[model samples]
Target: MRKPWCSTSSLALALVTVIVVGLAGAANAQGAAPAPAGPPPPAPTADEIKKVTEYYLRGKDVGPILMELVVCKKMGKSAENKSICEEKHGDTLKKGDPLIAFTRFFVPKGAKYEDLKVKFLLNGEVRSTSDFTLQESWTGYGNYKQTTASKPGTWEILVLRGETQLATAKVTVVE
Candidate 1:
């Protein structure tokens, strides 16, 4: 009989070439090559990221809402749990008068109970800061108690969520 058109070794070599090409094409079609085998990355450490002081509403980019911010002579809540402001005064506040900075706000849906901040500033200087839990209807208040050391000048109240300033109210304080 005539010798086979291809030797056994050549057939084997041809078969190996076909398999390598097929595997390469399949890999390309699937995706990139597999990652090199190695030890897993080190676990993250707590100090890697700084603690976040500001928080977003409902994990969304939206911020909280401040409906009304008033600086009044007196502030209290009614028996029905509604806010009451007496002698609403923003034009000028008498030094040593019972001064109150009250704010009514609406926390975004799913953001209620989250922590917010109210800052009391006197002539652009932070006098005090208070934290309040966002309520469904209204929340926030800061008492600008006029102490002997309390300076008489422009007083401001600011509502903030994290680094975002939501609202601000200004009142002039007089001696």
Candidate 2:
């Protein structure tokens, strides 16, 4: 017969201990406890977009920003041929120039975001609307831009996510 030390209760206790130790080991294998969770930051508004672009991109004095139009720019084509500001900044684009838009920017954590709602404003009027979705990359920054013929004036480009503006720039289009 079996010994008293190998009773049913003893086996059950041993099994539980093994299970507990295995679970603890698994948890340890995983990294440390994640940071406290909370609601994400509210997307900045058009007004907020202006402020941020001004602070980081532009100085206290909001001066006119020239659009960096480009020729070999791909609005968003093949996977390998997608346009990026870091790659293609701007080209020569004149007034009444169809599909003449210099599209690209350096997003802080662009990959974490969605397609940004973009608007091209002239002098203060809305010229065109474009939405940008950040493509995957080695860096968090991504690029997406829209091209449309513009009139001769100051083209205020506002990059937005919803009503909140993410970035801003000004481009002078001449005739």
Name the candidate that leads on lDDT.
1
Model 1, 1-175: lDDT tens digits are: 8989999878865865565466446534443223236998785443331111122224324545666676667644443223455557757777776656666554433455455777888889988887766532212222222222166898887877776787787777788
Q: For residue 8, what is the lDDT in candidate 1?
A: 84
lDDT of each: 0.56, 0.48
The collision pairs in model 2 are 44-164, 45-164, 45-165, 65-170, 67-171, 68-90, 69-90, 69-91, 70-91, 115-132
Give the Cα error of residue 19 in candidate 2, in Å.
Answer: 31
The superposed Cα distance between candidate 2 and the true structure at residue 110, in angstroms, equals: 13
Off by over 4 Å in 2: 1-79, 85-93, 98-112, 134-138
Q: What TM-score against the true fold does each predicted structure earn?
A: 0.53, 0.41
Tens-digit lDDT string for candidate 2 (53-128): 3333333132222223343223444443344322333433467654433433333211234546667787899867
Q: For each candidate, how many residue pairs have backbone atoms clashing (under 3 Å)?
A: 1, 10
